[model samples]
Target: MKLVKSQPWRNPDTVLAQLIQSCARTRNLDRGKQLHAHLVASGATPSTFVANHLISMYAKCGDLYHAIALFDRMPQRNLVTWTAMISSFSQNNKFGDALRTFSSMCAAGIKPTQFALSSAIQASAFFASLEFGKQMHCLSVKLGYDVELFVGSNLADMYSKCGSLVDACRVFDEMPDKDEVAWTAMIDGYTKNGSFEEAIVAFRDMLRGGTVVIDQHLLCSVLSACGGLKAGKLGRCLHSCVVKLGLESDTFIGNALVNMYAKAGDMESASSVVGMNSHGWNVVSCSSLIDGYVEMDQIEEASRAYISSRRQGIEPNEFTFSSMIKACASQAALEQGIQLHAQVMKTSFVRDLFVSSTLIDMYGKCGLLNSSIQVFDEIQHPSDISWNSIVGVFAQHGRGKEAVRALNRMISRGNKPNHITFVSLLMACSHAGLVEEGLEYFYSMNKTCDIEPREEHYACVIDMLGRAGRLEEAREFIAGMPFEPNAYGWCSLLGACRTHGEKELGELAAEKLMKLEPENSGIHILLSSIYASMGQWEDVKAVRKLMRDSRVKKLPGFSWVDVNNKTHMFGAEDWSHPQKEEIYEKLEELMVKIRKAGYVPFTGSMPCNLEESLKERLLHHHSERIAVAFALISMPATKPIIVKKNLRVCVDCHSAIKLISKVEGREIIVRDNARFHHFADGMCSCGDYW
Candidate 1:
């Protein structure tokens, strides 16, 4: 420093003191070296204070090699010197070195300071080693540093990071003086562990205590909790607090606000927050908006926002590309996704695990399974998520045996199969009607893989058994479940019963479903359809009465198809299209051709108790049928038609589409609420398994 150089009249100790302080503050390594030379020339005994400051300066500057060299050459050392070196390694992302240095300090018989203890505990968290963290806790207690505030806060954080939330809470509870940093750490720990409600509660307690200063970091943690819990009212309250506290101008706080509203499903508020803020869009803001749109199923809006953001000069990161590509998958816009894929390949982000996995999902959802496999093959050291994505795509495409082979391969490659992997495998077997195979996999989950079957796995097993006309065994399996079956398990059984014409068991499963989810209109509708299929008109009327009494309404079925880069949506009996007349005419002609090709009007799946003529007429107006009719009129017959539905395809429409696909000599791909169905030459990919 010039201040040190100009002080020639000052004593050597005073000059060295000033220089060390200046170097530590600014992390000026060159000046620190010059000062060290001056210290040597002065011939003064090198004080531990001066050495510690020099080491801290080097460590803070990320020159760990210099810091370690200085430490090793020190004639004497103190707690500050050891702590400075450990923190240097910790801050530079060399967590293993930090831990080893702490060990060396202990072996050197130097008692640790509170700062050293905190840095060592934090390094354990960064390492994500529970054993090391517990050892640190034991050491903290042994050395009488466990009760210190800084050490306590770090212990809480370390436990949470190691997935020991209970111990974290215990540490927080045992703390005597919880300052702002301590409280913030606890709240963040709760949020990190998915204890959103507890995080909010802690925030409320912190506010009521009024002893700590609430800063931007604290506000961001609470906002994240609100978002995770979907507590819109609380989130709005936090928004007000941000305004009152004058934090609205902060870009990071603004990003948190956007995330809170987006995760709360209030995208209108989220977009308005983004628009009103003067802060320009960054990667986080753009990614938040795109991800929110995808979560809301607003694929078109996500596309527009992505394009607009790129025009505004904000480069998309891996998260942004992943969200946008998933939106393309949802829209089944294969061409748009391909263009995005090209952009990704041009950049280094194509190698990112999330982006690559999303590419596979996009191709699979768009019915480009070959392209999906190609992407899978190109990935280097694919994570379990990548493997699961490819396996899921195969399952969705109705390739059960191949999916099983992939699962085995994943295991052989040393990637232990998680619960999600088995879920994919069981789903594949269900889609392919492999009842026995599904059963074996379900059992193997616990016996071989040591993975417990969650409710979804049981649902798959039920669906598999029900698909094969083994409704009785499916019921027995549910009764024998280790835990109470969730609503999905019962709903799957009901759907299977409806498919297999097991009216009695179907009624039982529907009753169970209604009791578990009385407000679910789909369950009531399924029950009504089951009764109608059995020619029980009175039961259908009773179910309808029950629905009316409960005031539960079914979601109106709608189907969407993309053509020429534009998406068009159609609902049952829809007449809002400008080409309605032409669409209706095409539908009539197609009906005639399919009828001539031995396609009978099937109304057994319709829930309404009406005359045969009216039922058949109503079936013709189903949303998917209308969407297909419109597609046939709007596009060439040689190109395949892909339609996405909001609910399961009715049996009548499915059968009708199969015949139409054969008669029109066109391939028709339909994605219902559950899986994809590709119909060609009067055959469906599901092979009537569903």
Candidate 2:
């Protein structure tokens, strides 16, 4: 593999030029060094022309040290030499060096060409230096190079990177000719700024004009824009283009296709793309599938996908692990979450910002607050997300004062509180019956933190006041909002009304909520509960009949318990368990003990009017009771029982569980849709506020 010295000498310059080109293309560092030796032995001083090519050759081969040394030794410097050096710095991710080199070139009284200016603009964009980018733009305008295709595209991208989408669009509009590069830059800018509609418009213009060829990269960006907008029709159009261009085998496009379909909620298409061998499924494709499944609330399916990913050699990356952890949190799978944490600790992603934050959330949702606190304490420098997660966990567990203290510490560390931080703080105050503190924080949202309150913030305020039994004040606050309250606001008031036994306000809130969210069958149940509380059996029957007429079916209440590393699910009056008879017998014995301890079942909890005996029987067989019965019989008395419920615990069950916890001398942790309830010694951790 050695180069011959005695070669044709008729055209020595052309031969050396060809050799350098060949070396640059093939990245043959050895042959490139040999060519340098031949140049030195020929006794011909390297001209500016030959030196420029040598610098470019070394730079393209990824040998930046040699490229810089050769450039410094050159007796002469030209525009191409400066451009190549700047590009070399940029390609190596040394953006600061690239900018410094450009300054040096300017000090030498050299005029920059279009390519040199473009490289400097790109460096500014990478650093997101808005002022520096403006200076470069002014210089380009003064030099009459701003209109050039290469410089124009770089300027557009630079503005976008600085988060100035308006300026980016203005620069794009000023360009005389629109090329594929220009279109791609504009599309990327809109997508990055969350202007999905504008991005779609620009892409449509590109297709109608037909002046520029749509390359795979341009199409990829547009597909992402479509996904953001959930424009599945447009995505299918792009998919067709991908097939027509025969770019289906391209790995990057294949991943984008899967992501687009997943985000659009077209799971069938996304799964099909992954299943096709021609699409070249990789780690990203599988990760997208997992995320999509989580978004669809298919936690079990997401877990199966994670297992399948591990069976293959494709190791899960940060995004993969984070998505899987979220799935576990949603399912309340504590054992699986602990296993995943062990796997994460073996990799560097355990310390990653997103993975660490997600781990805290997963542990908190699993009723493992100690583990959550440990994860939070171990973070060397927590970001806003980490702070929010810790504060939220404390709030969710009914530790309101602790959450407030954590927020104070977060601010003391020089981290500014955002809207999400305020939300967590407000929710904490609400759950702990701190109505005054919650109101103070809600009012301070705009004045102190410069954060305008959104609908969610207003909803939190309504919930806090309502939970405190201030029903009239809550209604007045809703009436005084800048805009009509959303469904969440009305639903919060409805929940509060139900809690405080205000049938009139509850019915009004239910009317508004029904108008906004007619398909929400949970609203009907809440209204029925309100009527049942007032002894209006006919009104409850009417509500039930309306539901039946409309075919509105409520989600059945389900509970899950993990024992011996296996999760068991139970539905209302479920008798499918292998030890159903034993569970019932144990429940009967517990009922006797609870009755002797002054436990009386609240028959009003039943929405339907039935015989007193029938209502009591139905209340005895609720899903949570069945799950608790199984846990009490299966596990040791010293161990605490944790049950996860899909719906809120009814008043009858909540009352029964409290007495049972005291009778059996066991701690029971129940996590419903909204928050955690810890029952011990005949008292609930929520303080009966929820």
- Model 2 ranges off by over 4 Å: 1-11, 589-600, 636-640, 658-667, 673-687
lDDT of 2 by residue, 381-440 (tens): 998899999998887776779888998898899778888888888888887888898888
Indicate the residue-level lDDT of 321 in model 1.
Answer: 92
Clashing pairs in 1: none
Among all windows of 10 consecutive residues in model 2, the one with the lowest summed lDDT is: 1-10
Against the correct fold, how does model 1 do in TM-score?
Answer: 0.86
lDDT of 1 at 425: 91
In candidate 1 the C-alpha lDDT for residue 358 amounts to 97
- Over the stretch 479-544, how does candidate 1's per-residue lDDT look in tens digits? 899876678778878888887788888888888888898998889888888888888888889999
lDDT of each: 0.86, 0.86
TM-score: which candidate is best? Answer: 2
